[model samples]
Target chain A: MDASLLTIQPASPEPIYRQIVEQLRRLIAGGQLGAGDLLPSVRDVAAFHAINPMTVSRAYGMAESEGLLERLRGKGMAVAATVRPTQTQTQRLALLEPQLQALVRHARELELPADAVLRRLGRLLED
Target chain B: MNAMLKDAADRPGPPLAARDLGHGYEGATVLRGIDLDIAAGSVLGLIGRNGAGKSTLLRALLGLLEPTTGETRVFGKPALAMDDGIRQRIAYVPQQPEALAWLTVAQMFDYLGRFYPRWNHAFARDTLARWQLPANKLFGKLSPGERQRVELVRALASEPELLVLDEPAAALDPVARRELLREIALRACEAGITVVFSTHIVSDLERVASDIAFLHQGRLLLHCPVDDTKERYARLWLPARLGPHAPASTLGRRSHADGSVSVVIERDAHGRWPDEAAQPGVRLDVLGLEDLFVEIAE
Candidate 1:
């Protein structure tokens, strides 16, 4: 993956690591990345982003711990198998619904019709 | 050996792992056999006197310096082989903001924005405005504080997963320092970005760091959580008594028996002290990171 593909939002009260994790998770779920795909090494990520390897390492470690990715002994990290739909997933996805709904509500407030919204959503999904 | 390996295998892997990390100048060794692990999403403050290899360690971690001996991995990936895609997720701010001196503030942004596909233009603009950095001014023309702000903007703009800062606030004024620290703290708390910052100033570490790794003589003398250090260490004031013989159960060495003897205790939980001194004037004071640094350095 090119470093240019990653966007960072400093204003969002989110810590940099969580932002990276969330973005990677979204990318994986969206199929931009897949199982067996190798991620960048921590130092490379840090230098490219001009942050600390420790922070990137933390995010990777969290992802690994959560089973989002698997670590090979000498090979780099790879996306884990598709996440199972456990009770936790249902509850977590439920919690995220409100945020997604708010985004849709904002789109509606902007006077965007359902077709426009759907089109944009489809485009985002395609991306 | 197998049992020891099994025991080691049973433990969790380090948050940050470096293998046989070595660096040097000419023939002298600056860092050697350095192996370190910081827990996930925790703050680790690196401290050492001048020329004690703190900066070198940071550079090595960033792959800025080619190590002489071993390798480093963030999480578990080899740092040396980090791909550009992976690099997008990490952030590093050096101690000195000299890398982009030729570009104006605006140009610097424009240049860096090209590298990160996800660069947030609005956030960068807003931060520039907040810092009052003149977009037209060349980076070299900015004052130290202003330059530091530029570095801050660049680092934060990336929304990095890991933040490695080398004395990031060294040039900032007190208020700016506090503001930056608060901002960093907020990021760490909300986003879980792991932070490893190096500083000679103890107060800075005390204000934001949860864990500290003391580097003395190119070696890590102690690495522990901040709370552990505070709760376990105490300053002991012993009155000269007990027939001039000092108690042997102290963490620090006995002071010369002047009128009053003072020692630092590493493990003191109870509020009371044994009444064996001549004047019975024993008092305990909690030692902060600064005090701890002074004692350890001594």
Candidate 2:
């Protein structure tokens, strides 16, 4: 996998390692990363992102525990040979739950009507 | 087996420790009541603004300067009286690395290598080649960044169990800095070398430091794991109309001309953000290391 594909927001509320885990999950679910694919070494990801290697290791470990990744003998980590099922449509859509909540919260904060906010979201999705 | 690694497992306490460390120069205190501990396999990033006593604290920890009050220890022995056996396992790169002007890089390395029984010449040679440092160049003729790299190579070649770096990357370009961070991470993760490095560059600290220490005005303000810091500290933006009602968690506050106020706050022990911050008209935001430094140290 291209380590560059994974980036973390330092200022985000979520911890850095958790961000890595979530991004990797999305990639795996989307088939961007396939079974037996070599995941970037902890050092590569850490050096590229300027994050602690231990943080990268923790993310990889979490993914391993969840069956998304597996460690190979003397070869570091790789995508699991047998992947779990791809996320269902609802499950995939659920990935946007936090973002949708933010949109609603901001719309409320701005005192925009539901119809207007939905119109804006509709236009954005069309784009 | 290397002497440094032979009995490391038998050691009892933290690799490095300082108790209520204080230092004064010409009646002015540069560090006060600073207590810090570095474990065997962790990295601690020491961060403070200029004149915030970062260099002083590092020097005190290395026993290069005797603190006016308190004490420091390496390998369970008082730093000031550390014997050669303990000293051999520790390496320090000072903020300004001084080298003799006449010697070339190879000469300098050769001279220094004579002092350490475990110095790895091949590793030093390979690192110098990788870093693109010219071995035949006069030590003093090299640029500041080159000199810093040379100092780091020297420090790493000895394979020290505990490494102390003071602003080691301040002179390097971004690429060099990244390479240095990678090497530090590799050593700490693979060899269990303990590292304590001080840097003004907050992003560098975010990269490889397991824990971070914030020093302000000669005091050690905060020292904790980096992730816990994110969990415990936050920033809240409130509409100006609400007026400035100071909450118990407020650490610092700033008001903008645009009718909003931003306040730094600490989360309660139960991991709860400030009560008011969760209410309408207030937005709670997480802070990165740079912002945290500004909030707590400014």
Candidate 3:
């Protein structure tokens, strides 16, 4: 992916490292960054965004710990070749925590029952 | 100091260090009792209000000015007794560069390049072209922003092991500021250059600084890694009823008309808030870098 695809908000209360990690995780989950896609080097990202390289390194380190990324010898970082096989199904689902939270909140505010919301979700998934 | 910590003799010294460094002029102390050791290859951002002695501190650190008391060590030698060999390894750009103003930008660079052993002529030429600066124009004739950029180019062209700037972005437009920040990040990441720059712009510091030194009234109030800022200090609020129990001393404190008290507090070595935070009606807030500076500097 191009460095321009990674957006950074310097004014946000959230730490920059967390911002990068969240964006990369979402992109990976959405298949925008497919398996084996080579990630940009830390120096390039730092230079492009004018941010500390250590901050970028820290985010990459967290992703590696989460099994979402792997480092290749002499090739820098890349998306893990396979889905994070070690993470349990429930753990993988946890990546959608924000969307699930919004869905639940809106369903509750709309006075929709949990069963109805699940059925709607099922229908959407089938479609 | 840890058992694993190397002996002073065995360890390589940081590029910059000060011990009990103090300075004053005309019977007014601008800075005092500063002890700082900048980690090698780390970018240190100095911040303070106007006339808070940031310039004075940097001058003393760079051996350009003698402090009233204490001493500084640059490259393992006394700051005041620096030799040309050591001086050539460091580059400093002042808030306003007045030297060689009559010379054309090209001529000025030519002279400086001769003196700086490791000057990068191609980098200087390329940046001037990219920024559209007229190298043929007299240095004094350029706009303040343009002059500042020329000074920046001069500094970076030296490829100094240590780079220091006083408010390098003060005169630049947003685009120029971002470009300067990008250049700093690129150098630090690729060349492992140690950099110290004083700036009031917090966003710029957030982008490129690995460490921050908040100078207040000539004293270093805070010196820590950028990432540690949010977790290190907090603002504690106490409603009027609970205000009486608030800590007597804090980094900064204020009492509202309604008797509510707001005080800036810090986590202890163990990362635990003070006991009072657990009291009923007390609220703790993690402060952003700007907010933390405001809370203390105000």
Name the top lDDT candidate: 3
Pairwise TM-score winner, candidates 1 and 2 = 2
The model with the greater DockQ, 2 or 3, is 2
For residues B185-294, write the lDDT of model 2, one tens digit per residue. Answer: 88876677899999988777876889999888899888898887787888777787764653554367777898777788887788777677656656666778788788
Give the per-residue lDDT digits (tens) of candidate 3, residues B150-185. 988999999887899999988777887899899888
Candidate closest to the true structure, highest DockQ: 2
Per-residue lDDT for B1-298 in model 1, tens only?
Answer: 3442443355344436787788888999999888887766677889988888998999888777789888888655677776776577577877667877889989989988999765778888997887788999999998877887888888888776578888876867676676667666656665666789998877667556768888876777778865556656655665556325445542454465476666665543564444432233455555666676676666
Runs of candidate 3 exceeding 4 Å displacement: A82-89, A92-127, B1-12, B247-249
State how far residue B205 of model 2 sits from its true place (Å).
1.6
Best by TM-score: 2
Q: List the residue pairs that clash in candidate 3.
A: none
Q: lDDT at A4 for candidate 2? A: 93
Judging by TM-score, tell me the better candidate of 2 and 3. Answer: 2
DockQ of each: 0.01, 0.42, 0.30
Error (Å) of candidate 3 at residue B219 is: 1.1
Model 2 residue B62 CA deviation (Å) reads 1.2
Which RMSD does model 2 reach against the true structure? 3.1
Q: Compose the digit string of candidate 2's lDDT tens values, residues A66-118.
A: 88899999989999998744867886786788788887667655657899888
Q: Where in model 2 is the C-alpha error above 4 Å?
A: A2-5, A8-14, A47-50, A71-76, A81-85, A104-127, B1-5, B99-102, B130-134, B137-144, B257-259
